[model samples]
Target: MEHANTAQLGRGPVTSSDLRRRQNGRLASIGEPLPIGMRGADAGGREGRSEAPLPLILRRVHPLILLSTVLMCLATGARAQQSSTATYSVTFQGNWTTASTPGGVVGGAHFTTLIGAVHNDQVTFWESGGTATAGVERVAELGSTGTFKSEINANSNAISVIEQSVSGGGTGSATFNVTVTSDHPRVTLLSMIGPSPDWFVGVSGRSLLNTQGNWQSPIQVDLFPYDAGTEDGTEFSLSNPATSPQGVITSIRGTGKFSNVRMARLTFTLQSAIPPPTPPPPPPGGGGFGGGGGAPRTSAPSAPRNLTAVGGDGEVVLTWEPPLRDGGADITDYEYRVDR
Candidate 1:
């Protein structure tokens, strides 16, 4: 045992042999953890061998063992944080009846489990103008997963990771594994349904407030089908792109058709000590960009108030004071998306 002047202390000559002997004594303690770096001088002569050549003798770990240990930890972390910034293979397991095309729901099913993927700020769900990437399009059109992996790689941000899975609608559950960067740990399961095009099961920025490592069980999320707005409307591969015509604005865009897929408002909140997003002050007024856009629509900026995620009913409600940018429209609508 060694003691120092309220600073650092360590045992003598902690060589590999010493570490191995200590580890052999206990099953739980196997690998050599990065030891505390300290020297006798810093400790004010904590040990009698203050003048030893290698004062701080951390047991040199065997290269293979060290690599294995690091890999094991990385894998554990990947699974622990399956939700956050990685790709999770989502499989549609439940009864899917919604029309994958623009047609209405044909059967009793209301878009059950549709395989989907999630990431931070950037999204895998479809968006306006852009067609569903080949992966998403294939999933929507043919129930195939072959190309989705490539598309996910092409569409992800440097911080994103991908995990995926799918299953045929039969007797058992279609299982999939969630893959992601070993860091971001707040995301959860992503789902998708087939009846609709560009529609899907999306679980965006989730909260890891309580969960750290192991799961507590599964929670039922809305799995709202976001109209990636990709491919106009969700369409299937036709002998011609005309036969399955998928780009009709029905419920999702509500722009062309005005139906307002109105699947219910979904809100995802990413809470972290994130650096406050710097919003460029309205472009220089006076005709250059923000200049000619009128008097910059005088309004109050939106002050973040309270954000609530109501369980069971499945709704994320955010309430805030009117924005400084309010143009007096009574704040008709508010849009919320994951902020990475």
Candidate 2:
């Protein structure tokens, strides 16, 4: 015997009346409000009481569930508010030549390996009018970077270190890429002016972000020679003794021996940027039952499909199909490694 409010599936062609009765019965079973004219009555014209409405359903939701949902939304918004990372190609363009320094040029005059860090305002790697650390002294006097690198690594505020050197001349350029976030937007770079007692050229605590909190591109800074204040040598290639008491770092420009000319220039050009993610929208109706926001969280893309490799003469050819899912953002690159 068929029930008074049963949905007939895979039995004959079901009528519209059958579907309406099935829907009403399901809603009533779950304590959901019935449609107009269907209240207080069953499909077979039997009298029955209707279920409570949406407000009652909301009241049944646990307090903890609502609190958890609110916390999740707040966390999502915090992640979205984080600033993006910006990468730049920092180029050290050395102009150390007889023409620039005039009477102070010496043979084999070259810049040592460049070393620097991208840090925050809380730390200043090396600054004018400040006494040089052991790392700074070595870099300015002997063109060594070991101590400086260690110093940078130990500092919690330093984010990245850049190290590269020009090849074979006083007048050359070397470029390396560096990345910086809003929290550590300042840059400090230094290189020794070789054959000098304690001379170096650099910029200290220069910020890459502008006042409007945007990354600045193609920044050009004129470099001047500064005395490390550890040695008392007045001319390049002179064997001078260290100062009795360490002095403050001071600019050597227009100080008798050095001419008022820039020894080098630094140019930072933007390479790429990864902007922060956008937050999900808030729940509808200020949150509660049937409130409609909160989309699914995205993650790394699925593995590639149909990967294949063919061996050749001293080489290999590989190919594969794109992943079935790309999470939420577009895939920008792929990295591969080979193990032998």
Model 1, residue 243: distance off in Å is 12
Candidate lDDT (C-alpha), each: 0.33, 0.65
Relative to the unseen true structure, what is the C-alpha lDDT of residue 196 in candidate 1, on a scale of 0 to 100?
43
lDDT tens digits, residue span 10-33, model 2: 323222232222233343332355
Worst 10 residues of 1 by lDDT: 71-80
Would you list the clashing residue pairs of candidate 2? none
- For each candidate in turn, the TM-score is 0.32, 0.60
As a whole number from 0 to 100, the lDDT of residue 169 in candidate 2 is: 69
Q: Give candidate 1's root-mean-square deviation (CA, Å).
A: 24.9
TM-score of 1: 0.32
